[model samples]
Target chain A: MRDGEPLVRWAWIGDHVDELAHYTGVHLRLGLLPVLLGLLISIPLGILCHRWRWAYPPTLTAANILYSIPSLALFMIFVRYTGLTERTVMIPLTLYTLSVLIPNVVDGLAAVPDPVRQAATAMGFSTVRRVVQVELPIAVPVVVAGVRVAAVSSISLVAVGQLIGQGGLGYYITRGLQLDFPTPIITATVLIMLLALVTDALLVLAQRLLTPWARGKGAAA
Target chain B: MNGFLNQLSLVGDWLTSSQQWHGPDGIPHRLLEHLTYSGLSLLFAALIGLSLGLLVGHTGRGAFAVASVANLARAVPTFGLVVLVVTLAGLSTAPVLVALTALAVPPILINTFEGIRGVDPDARDAARGMGMTGWEVLLKAEVPMALPLILLGLRVAAIQVVATATVAAYPGLGGLGRFIVDGLARNDYELVIGGSAVVVLLALVVQAVFTALRRVVVSPGLRAPASGP
Candidate 1:
């Protein structure tokens, strides 16, 4: 009877949606916090380099070098110090995000027509105001694209965190494999794909929501 | 880091053990027995994928069906699917090869079909007007233009095989993944890092080799369009 419990998977998803939501929310927070941190750090870094030409290649190099560190190896490095808490997950994942996010953000900002910035400056817009009103708004779509990539990568990386015993859906996959329960393993695996799809869809919707100007441009075009 | 230096030395040390390399382990002899498993599977898949894609493109009506099948297969996580295959097929190199090849076929199939579909219509018309047979037109006109996209599919398959060939470790054929899994078990970070480094290096090397081959085989005009818009 007790053995049957393992096979008796329920529609607990309905009653337990909140708990699942919490799990996904934490995982997203874990994944996105670093992305958020990375964006905060690297976008400004990217902007500065974009504003000043010399910092581009070297800043870009730092991100590339960081990216080549494979996710599992990175998780190991984090484990050596932090012993597999959220910090361990965030640090390497954040570092990884800088590579993907910075280049896009910088590219988007650079894609801003030179005339627009010059015209903003000529209009006596303060440097900060020019960047705020002119640059970020124009670069929003590309930055959002970068955010999409980071979101996907980080959600996938959440599985690695489960390797160290974190309790996301990855825990279900890893734990089931260990115990020889394919049901849980398959369920968890499907859950992960679902989670990733949901994250991607949310990001897409968020991009549309945040960039009303894109819709306006689409309409006019 | 010192850790990095230590790994380089270990690789250097292992390279010296010829027996292990040729036979099993402790050597860097590039064992053919294990290498052929992945190679043959990829070869088999590419052959099937190309044939199916060609049939679909020439037929055209069944494309939506093929696309749905490829999408469904590709959606399965390589790790989970491999595990499922192994459980069903019994633990051995067979399941690993099947899983990798199945995983490989979709990309190649999709690319080849799209590539053939994208062959310029005017070019096809001109070839026909020039007194070419249907087969002659396809061979001389369509395949030549589609070669780069076909090669790109093969390249993706090659990289995927290189990475996924590691997953064969669980079934006991002992690719780079064996080192990673063992390293994880032993808490030897160096082994995991070293193993991954090798896999990454292998992938990069394969990519470079294919890229160079693409330059040699693909015609200049076709190459540019086949590669990008």
Candidate 2:
């Protein structure tokens, strides 16, 4: 940002359109993959915690400790094993999601009304079937609420991976800083924020579609 | 397995070496810088977030707006904010501080508002029944009742700030993150690992301090049952 240079050079964006699109794809991959993986891991872990109340406190404490470690630090720590690759970034991000996802999953399951559970049990549904078909469906709204938070945070955090040479849009931010230019920095920042918001909106829409019954009852979680 | 142990020992050696502890660029000075950045950002964030949260929560107004704004804030990337601020303003600690404070505010504000809002109506009524005014009721009854949540919010904010202030080093500002950023540039894995280890430790210490603070500050009667064995 020099005295005479414009804050954002429109011409630069025009030239970097392909590059921007490439990074957007990379950014989405870096950000969303961990969330997908985390959801897979959290569901079972959440079920376990919900089933055995004793498991929750320790699980939650471990997740909180993992969550508190900064993204950069975690990235560096993982680099020891994973090298300077996408795995280094995704592994930490996946661990980070547990803190948010596990709680939400457990809460979503817990929100199932007792009578609803009893009714499911009475209807000749097997234990596994009842949990899968009845309980989980009821839990969709709450689970999706957690997913929305996890997705947005994961997306934003993906940019910090740039410090370790893997951040999606974060690359441009650091590049812009090193080059003493503002256009890429502003552009990347806007895109990352846009990506987060858009992902969040999509999750909310998905929640609505998944739990049509919950539509007019106010926001999830 | 061997490589992992080797790296661990490397990190241990880096930590134990006395030379790493003595200079202006050493661990002690960097730790101090890290703490200063974290403390200052937390102070500003607490001031702004706490005051606004208290006002909104006590009045039972603007809860929705505060929550939406806080959630939106959470979506902003700390790295982007740091570079954007530094690129807009010149390279100085000011930009770093601004970014760090922005990162920390949302958690504190939302938690405080939620805490105060969650206070029992019966408690408020009892305070009024005791002839306390609005401010007195808020201070004496609502705040004390909300202390746990408010403290939780502060703890969250403190940990976040401690973590993010590391990014302050990206703009050539000094802190523990200086090691990670500079270490990567120099291909110094030892420095990177050691710096990251210290940061994780610091964050844990902050978490522990807050947990202990909660036990001391929050009255036993007001403390939630789940917090106890």
Give the top-scoring candidate (DockQ).
2
Put down candidate 1 lDDT per residue, B1-229, tens digits, no spaces.
Answer: 7755666676555445444345454324332433576587789889999998877875576899877666455335455555545544556777678878887898789888988888888998999999998888878888888889888778767655665566555434566666666777788766665565565565556656776888898998765522210
Which candidate wins on lDDT?
Answer: 2
For model 1, residues A46-125, the per-residue Cα lDDT tens digits are 78977887777667655655554545545655565677587877888788778768777777898889999999999999
Clashing pairs in 1: B21-B27, B21-B29
Badly placed stretches (over 4 Å) of model 2 are A219-221, B225-229
> What RMSD, rounded to one decimal, does every model reach?
5.8, 2.1
| Residue-wise C-alpha lDDT for candidate 2, range A92-195, written one tens digit per residue | 99998888899888988999999999999999999889989999999898788788888898999898888878999999999999899999999998898899
- Per-residue lDDT over B53-167 for candidate 2, one digit per residue giving the tens place of the 0 to 100 score: 9999999899899989988987898888888888889888877898898888888899899999999899899999999999999999999999988887888788778877887
DockQ, all models? 0.17, 0.56
